[model samples]
Target: MCGIVGAVAQRNIVPILLEGLKRLEYRGYDSCGVAVNNGGLKRARSVSRVAELERQVDDSGFAGNTGIAHTRWATHGVPATNNAHPHFSARDGEQRIGLVHNGIIENYEEIRTELKALGYVFESQTDTEAIAHLVNHMYDGDLLSTVQKAVKRLHGAFAIAVFAKDEPQRIVGARLGCPLIVGLCDNENFLASDAMALAGSTDQIIYLEEGDVVDVRLDGVRIYDRDDQPVERRVQTVQAYSGAIELGPYRHYMQKEIFEQPRAISDTLEGVLGFAPDLFGPKAQDVFADIDSVLILACGTSYYSGMTAKYWLESLANLPTSVEIASEYRYRKPAVNPKALVVVISQSGETADTLAALKYAKELGHRHSLSICNVGTSAMVRETELSYLTRAGAEIGVASTKAFTTQLTALFLLTATLAKMRGKLDAEAEAFYLKSLRHLPTALQSVLALEPHIIAWSEAFARKENALFLGRGLHYPIALEGALKLKEISYIHAEAYPAGELKHGPLALVTEEMPVVTVAPNDTLIEKLKSNMQEVRARGGQLYVFADGDSQMSSSEGIHVIRLPEHYGLLSPILHVVPLQLLAYHTALARGTDVDKPRNLAKSVTVE
Candidate 1:
């Protein structure tokens, strides 16, 4: 994945390009570059951060209305200054154009061979550079027509921005299977990989649909179909605190996001409880009021949210519910029907595989699809007939924190509403679940106050190369999420196993060097998980556990404990996940790894 941003402003372009690249650095940071057309065309590249690119541009003082910049993630070429993007091509004596591209071109090899056959010499080892050359070769003196034709010949996922020498007044942008957004301003126009890049400059934007191209300039903005006919679209305003994108006073985004969970939960619950006609537990039952089956699909941490929801859906709703990882859902032909409700869960709402599964399900004739997503106006939100919003704000961290809890919160509320609709909930039953649900915000506050302990424990995991996590029932899926977070950010080799399955195969990996993290709360699985913890100790495996505060513990057993609050029920997984998130964040911090932008990991996966 890579980040692309372009600004054709009324004033200097270098400053806006620089600031925009820095804002998009989360999408990619391996290398960066910028191309500008002042009096003459100039391009700058850097192997380090965006600052180096800015420095070179400042030294050259290249400024123009039409310019393109890129923060590259190094997919096709090595991470080096030369491989950095805003790639360019010149016709030796006639024309030149700079290009910044996102997404992989699967047929680049074939196109490269064809270009060479036509006697065109190549420079860099990038699929994007080929795009510039192809545009130049196919140009008939019209930038828009040339780009439209060249893009028609290309195949695979790509979103590209082009700045031409002859067309100095306008910027050309197009997308197919990758993300691109056009931001409109009174005196300028912009094309960026995402709306966040244009946050300071403009809030009104039109998301470029697949196979669509746009020419943006100070005087006008025009969209065209693949056939080059001009089309019109209404612009939508972005909804977010412009300041929320900034780090504020925090040292890192992970820490800032962790502290924001209290408010994030509240915001998600805002207008949900009273004013929104029971968003948490309402309308869900109406849709599934007579349904006899349920299927949910999700990926990564969101999958854990689905797994927790499965438990509540089965217990509370008394419905046969199944949760499948998106990838696996495809290979196995699961039972489905018009009466079944399919749920898709994602934080960014752009996860490639999950979106694909949702699309596939829709094509297979399941129209009653529901999506639980954090971001509004996402493709997933648009695809689903029904959507539940998660209150977590912009999550810059590659590993999610607040989004996970909020998804579980929404899922649990759905379950309660389903149970109420199914006539399974009595007043006492409703009151019990509702009271526990109400106490969650305070419970989260308590867990957040325990951060000092998490920070201390992180020191051990920072040096640890391998670890294992264990849980059962709802927490089993959360255990998997915990291990994934550790492996993703901290670079620790970690695995998760159900406590009951310890004797199967994973138990063999148990050693004193491997810390066995058991998510043991005072639930039905407590006794069984305690037995599993002892089995690990018998094998000289060190134990680190999150146990209920009132649970019994023995110092002789050497089971280090993280005392949790008193609300242990179906909703406990939501709380149990907080420590693991903290542990993973602090551990990655101690290891000195990039917590917000993990290597080879993008904040949002927009391509399959």
Candidate 2:
């Protein structure tokens, strides 16, 4: 993933560009740079943070009213000063054109070969440099037309911002697969890959559709379609609070976000006073009546959320549900049920594979679509007919915490709504569910109080090389999520398995050196789960269980149990995951790993 920001204003905008890049640091970046047309194109690039790039800009005395900046997550080349963004194209000895890009150019090899044959020597090993060279070769004096023609020949997902020395008062941007937006102002205009980058500067934002080009000028902005037709896009007011970007007292954003779950889940469930068929949207009743099956599309933690919902949907809503990994779902030719509702779940709402999977399902004539996402301006929300916005605010940590729980809250609501539509939820049941929903924040508070105990467990986990997580039925997804979190941040080898499947294959790997973490809520499967625990004990496997208070589990011998405040019967997963999250957080903290920005992982997966 990468970030782009461009501005054309009356005053020097290098500070604005740098600030925008700083806001985009959450998206993850390997290198960063900025290009400003001060008399000529003055650019500075560094394979470091935006702060380092800011110091370089200050030292170089680079100032201009029109400019473009980029924070790149390298895909095509190694992250170096030469491979950084704001790549320059020189004619003779002067830098004539500058370009910054997000996403990959798939056919850059062919284009690079052609440009090489034309005697355009390349200076960097990047697909973006190919675009810079191609644009410089096709500069017909009009920056907009030149970019439009050049992009017509390119392939794959790209959001590009290009500026020329001759057109110092303007910046041209084009988008295909990746996201791009235009920010409106009185005497200035802005372009960025995300609207959050423009939150403090402008509230009025225009989300550009696919294959749209925009010419940002000092006075106004012009939008064009793919076929050279001028178009008007609706400018929506972004209601994001920029204060959420700050880390107040918490050690890391992940810690702050973990504590924010109470408010985030409360916000996500604010409008729902009681369970109704229309809780998701106006068409939920009809969609539920028409579809007898559900197809959930998601990735990473979102996919696990979908998997948890599958249990809820089949049991509570009485609907047949199937969950698929979005990346694999799009590529495989699977059976498409015409009466199935395709539910897409994503925290960013811009996950490339999940979006493609949604589109692919629609292309197969499965028309019913819904998205449970946090961002309202994301492509998943824009493309889907039915949408639920999870008010989790902005999740900056690479290992998502609040976003995951808030999404689970939304998915549970969706399940209850569908159940009410199918007459499976009576008045008494609906009232119980509503009370549970209303009490989630309080339940989460009780769980957060157990952080000290979980931190003790994490002390033992931090020194371990491998771990095993076990659960049955509904809690199985929670175990998977716990394993994912431990591996993501702590870099420990972890795996999860259904308790009944221990004898299948995973039991062979159990040892005294490995810790076994179990989600042991009081449920129908508790007896079987206890039997599974005995098997683990027989093999000398140390056990760490987050059990319900009424589960009668104790801390003895090889078994270590942290009892829950109470067993929250259908909503137990929501509370059970909190301790596991704290476990992962404290474990990573003890290991001295980068808890916020995990290595080789970005917060948002914007590209496939």
Candidate 3:
């Protein structure tokens, strides 16, 4: 998940480029660099943070009116100064081309062999270096045409920004599989992998489509389609949330986001008055009428949200459902039902594997597709026939909190809509579900009040090396999510298993040193879950349980219980997950780890 920013402007662009990279830092990166054309290609790169790169630029007196910058998440080489972005293509002892790229090149080995045979030498172990050399080799007095011809030979996904030493006032950009956007300002033009990079600088943004090439100049911009035909793209105005990116009173973005859940769910359910198929889209009524089953596709946290929805959809809507990891779904041929409604979930909507899976599903003749996402203008939204936009705002934390809850809120709405369409819900049932949804914000507030108790538990957890999470029935996915959050931010080895599955194998790993966390909602499985807890306690395993107020669970010699305010029967997963998030957050803080920007992880997985 790399980031790219480029600008053709009249003023010094180094500050703008550096600030853009800062905004994109949440996407995750290992190294950063910038290249400027001040009569010649002047570049600086570092494997350290962006702040260090800025210091190096200032010390070297680096300044330019036109430039390209990159924050790279390494895929082809090790994270080192040489592997950093803004890679160069030198000719006759002069760096002629400076290029920054996102995404991978599948046929780089073949291209590199051909380029090497043509006497082109590579200095970095990256697939992107091949593109730079190919561009330099194809330069015939025009940077735009040279890049256009070079990208035609590329075999895999890429979004690139390149500047030529001879064409100091111009920058060429192209996108195939990854995202790219153009920002418009007075006598200035910009290119970035994300519109957030140009938030304060420009409000007018143009999202480029697949296989589009853009040429940016100080006065204007030009675009070309895949077939070499000149084209015009619509420019839309975007309101930048300047205040949302700041950490106000909160220690980290993760903490602020965790506290923001109540408002996020409220915003996501803002306009809902009652259940209706049209809540999803204008065509939802027809789509719901035709579908016989549901197929959910996603990855990581989104996949877990789908797993929770499986219980909601099957039990409430009486529809058969299946959830698949998006990355694995596209690799093998599977039975595709033409009538099955395909639902894809993601927060950023730019997740590479999920987007690819959506395309693959369409190619396999799936007639109906829907996207539940936070970003309204993302590629997944554009590719699908219907979409539900979750108003979770901007999730800056690499470990998701508000986004995950907001997704569950959206999926629940979908379940209710389908239930209503199938005539399974009468007036009384509809009113009850609506009242429960309206009261979710208040319920979430009550759960947040339990943070002080969770913080006390976090101290004991921070000293441990491993954790085990258990749940039954509908809460099993919540247990998986809890384990994922613990391992993701706190860097602790954690695992989750269904309560019934513990005796099968996971119980052998239980001991006094292991902390077993359980989600005990007051559901039909409570008695069965009690038996599972007995098994854990009998094995001398320390237990930390999050139970509903009426579950009748209490703290004892080896058992530590934190009671939730109430039991939300159908929506308990959404409420049960908040404490686990807090447990992970405070644990990471106690361990002195980077809670916001965890090591080796990015907020958005834009590349496979």
Candidate 4:
């Protein structure tokens, strides 16, 4: 996935383009470039960060009222200056167009062959470069018509922004499977792959649907459908704040987001004094009445959240539930229960595989669909009939922290609401659940107080090459999440197993060199989990147990313990995950690895 930003304004728009790209750099940050239509065309490309792109532009002293910029996470080409975006198309002496694109163009090779036969030569090894040449070849001095024609010939996911030197006051954009938006301002107009890029300049945004072409000018904007008819789309205001992207006094975004858990969880639980079906959406009660089972679709951290919710949905609501990795779910033609409720979880709400999986579920005759997401304007939210928005503000870290916790909070609320509707909860039981939720912010703060202890463990963990995490019941998903964090940020090879399943196979990997992180939650499975820890000890493995105060596990010869203040009952996963996040962050800090933008990972996986 890549980030694209375009601007057409009465004043110079170079600053706006650069700042917008800076905000959207979390989507992709391998290389970046910007093209400006200043009388002729002026461009600067970089093989490094956005700051380097800005410096290159400054050193060249480029300025224009119309511009398009890109920050790329390389897919078709390697990360280099020539492979950077804002690709150009010019004849021997003629300059006509420059384009920035997000998403893959599946039919580029075929088009490139035709263009090459027609006397067009390519300068870079990118699918996006072909688009610029094709648009230039089809240009009849009408940029809108040319872009519309070029998009029709292409096949695959794309959100493209194009600018012509002849038509310097206009920018044309088109979208198919990826996201694109038009930002409205007083005397200016903007386009970006994400609405978060427009938060600083304008909150008013119009989301472009699939196969919609947009023509933006300094005065206004016009939307066109696939059949060349004009269409009117409603403008919506985005609630995200620009300040959330700032990392105030923190070393990395993961650290800042980890510390923001209390506020993020509180914002997610704002108006919920008691549980009700309307907490999700107006149609939630009716949907819950007909569905006898639940099927959750998600990927990466969101999939783990779905796994955690499967536990809650089955144990609390007494409903059958299944979780599937979205990428794998979409490919296999599995048996589907028509009455099952399909729930999709995504932090960005734009993950391509998850969206495809949701579509597949709907095509298989599942009528009711719901999305648990963070972004309101994303494709998943638009496709689902009912949805719950997680209020975790802009997550800049490639490794997720607050988004996972907030998803758990929202899913827990969904569980309680479903339980109430099914008559599984009495008035006193509902009141107790509400009270526990009200106390969650304080409980989270208490867990955050254990960071010093986690940091000490991280110091020793930094020296180790591998780790094993063990848990049972609902806490098993929490252990999976912990291992994922360590591998994502710290680059430590880690594996997680249900404590009962260790004897089946994973126990063979345990040794003195392997640090075994155990989640002993003082619940019904505590005895079984403790026995698993003993299995690790008998094999000469070191133990780091996050146990409850009354579990009686302490610092012994081979056993090390950090006892929590109190056990949080059903909400223990929400509390137990904080220290693991801290462990990953501090361990990455000790190992001198890039914590925020881990290698080969982007904050949002908008491509398949």
Better of 2 and 3 by lDDT: 3
81-117 in candidate 2: lDDT tens per residue?
9999899998887888999998888999999999999
Q: What is each predicted model's overall lDDT from 0 to 1? A: 0.82, 0.92, 0.94, 0.90
| Candidate that would win on TM-score | 3
Tens-digit lDDT string for candidate 1 (320-422)? 8888888777666655687778889998786767887887787777767788999787778777867889968787777888898889888876777677777
How many times do residue backbones clash in model 4? Answer: 0
Candidate 4 lDDT for residue 466: 96
Ranking by lDDT: 3, 2, 4, 1
Could you tell me how far off, in angstroms, the CA of residue 578 lies in candidate 1 after the best superposition?
Answer: 1.1
- Clash count for candidate 2 is 0
State the displacement of the C-alpha of residue 516, model 1, in Å, after optimal TM-score superposition: 0.8
Position 327, candidate 1: lDDT: 74
Provide the lDDT at 578 for model 1: 87
Which pairs of residues have clashing backbones in candidate 3?
Answer: none
Superposed by TM-score, candidate 2 places the C-alpha of residue 44 at a distance from the truth, in angstroms, of: 1.8
* Model 2 residue 47 CA deviation in Å: 2.0
Q: What is the TM-score of each candidate against the true structure?
A: 0.94, 0.98, 0.99, 0.98
Candidate 2 at 322: error in angstroms? 0.5
Between candidates 1 and 4, name the one with more favorable TM-score: 4
